[model samples]
Target: MKKLAIFLFASLLGATAQAAEYVIDTKGAHAFIQFRIKHLGYSWLYGRFDDFNGSFQYDESKPEASSINVNIDVNSLDSNHAERDKHLRGEDFLFVEKYPTATFKSTSYEPAGDGKGKLTGDLTLRGVTKPITIDVTHVGGGKDPWGGFRQGFTGSTEFKLKDFGIDYDLGPASQTVEMILDVEGIRK
Candidate 1:
């Protein structure tokens, strides 16, 4: 009877499990937000935001219920060229003076097994909000050297340049931009 009672208790506990909450480890430089766009149909221009932070909730048992939120500093864009970076920050592109921040809030997650899924979220940029879907892959998760648990994920999404109302005319080949996000979160 005691054995049966213990089994029933364990079953109840398992049924009540909840997702683990985590803060993106930006302070540790384990999180990054990057982008790539065609440069005049000749080559690709890659850049990354130096300042961004976020958090997420994930549970291996219920992956579909995971969620995440992130905020980015628009002025933190770096493209390795000072002149181009300046132009990108002006009225032609980001216009950081007017819109200094961007954000993403997850709406849903669809698991596809093998640590892959599609994450749909509302992305706000340049004062406009639109739904974007990211293809996400769970990197791995385990205990850190400091004895804290961590989870990591990599995701990518692409959207048309004009979708956010920044129609600076980058030509037909540069009509889209792709973003890559690598997030490692410490369990909280």
Candidate 2:
């Protein structure tokens, strides 16, 4: 009788549970979008976007019910140098004047076990839309002062620059670019 009573209570708790809400912290968050390719086959050069914003809806019980939305300012591209940043904003690469923002929205998510999962989404950059998959892991979750709850998540994804209409010829040294995103956002 005791075992049956415990089981009934557990089922009631599960049925009444709801997913939590997390607020994304833009100030504390970091979005590192980077890429590189062959530059005359000599060495690989890298660059990144310095500013961006986004948020996500995460429900561990329902992985497929999750989603993410992110927007990146194309003009914020920085290659650690002024000249390169200017060139990247021009018609050759991102064409910041034409398309001011790059965005991504997740279509679905699936847990791969051990707090890791796959997030597939449509990424739009420089007027080109492509499907991208990101490997994500839960960094941590907790509450801060001021009665606010937060969760941190980090994800990484890589793709060819040419596939996104970024066909700038950087010589034979760089042919493909590997992009990485080290993001930490509060769930809201």
Candidate 3:
């Protein structure tokens, strides 16, 4: 009976040392999902998805255990131009009516020095799932004035539009798209 009690106590201590999970704070207005793609090989066109929600598990003590998942509303894309936004949501691009959401699920996290890391995940876009890697930088984490614990991170990745079946060719400008994510999470 004494041995059993000691084993249970050890198990509890180990669990307490594990990572904590956090839910993405959608209401904070600090989280953003932005994109930039070349236009006509002359300039870059910028856009953002206004609606997204996600959660992450983070362990400062063991950063490799950290993982994240996010879902973005395709129809919420905004490019600052109504016409362009509409076109982007149409069949020529996202086809939001048929495939309304894009998602990312982290498979691995490799921490780099100075609060940076490479996060590799499976990205599902336009009904296709492909692996992608994002360079991540931990912005910071702390307690908020509202008495909530918060953490923030920034990540960026680039991919070809055609890789996810977005094959609309707008000349040289249609090849690649750069995606950036500024995410904040609240401890649950």
TM-score of each: 0.90, 0.79, 0.91
Report how far off residue 110 is in candidate 1 (Å): 0.2
Worst 10 residues of 3 by lDDT: 12-21
Q: Is candidate 1 or candidate 2 better by TM-score?
A: 1
Residue 68 of model 2, lDDT score: 82
lDDT of 1 by residue, 1-188 (tens): 99999999998677545788899999999999999999899999999999988899999988998999999998999999999999998888898999999999999999999999999999999889999999999999999999999999999999997999889978899999999999999999
Model 3, which residues run further than 4 Å from truth?
Answer: 1-17
**What would the TM-score be for candidate 3 when compared with the true structure?**
0.91
lDDT of 2 at 157: 76
Question: What number of clashing residue pairs does each candidate have, in the order they appear?
Answer: 0, 15, 0
Q: Candidate 2, residues 1-188: lDDT per residue as tens digits?
A: 99999999998676435455444465763446666655677776778777788777766666566778888888988778799789879998889999999999899888888878999999999999999999888777666675766666777777777899887777654556666666655545
Indicate which candidate wins on lDDT.
Answer: 1
Residue-by-residue lDDT tens digits, candidate 3, 1-188: 99999999998778656877889988878799999999899898999999999999898888888999999999999999999999999988999999999999999999998999999999999999999999999999999999988889999999999998888988975699999999999988
Greater-TM-score candidate between 2 and 3: 3
On the 0 to 100 scale, the lDDT of residue 107 in model 1 is: 99
Provide C-alpha RMSD values for all models, in order.
4.8, 5.9, 2.9
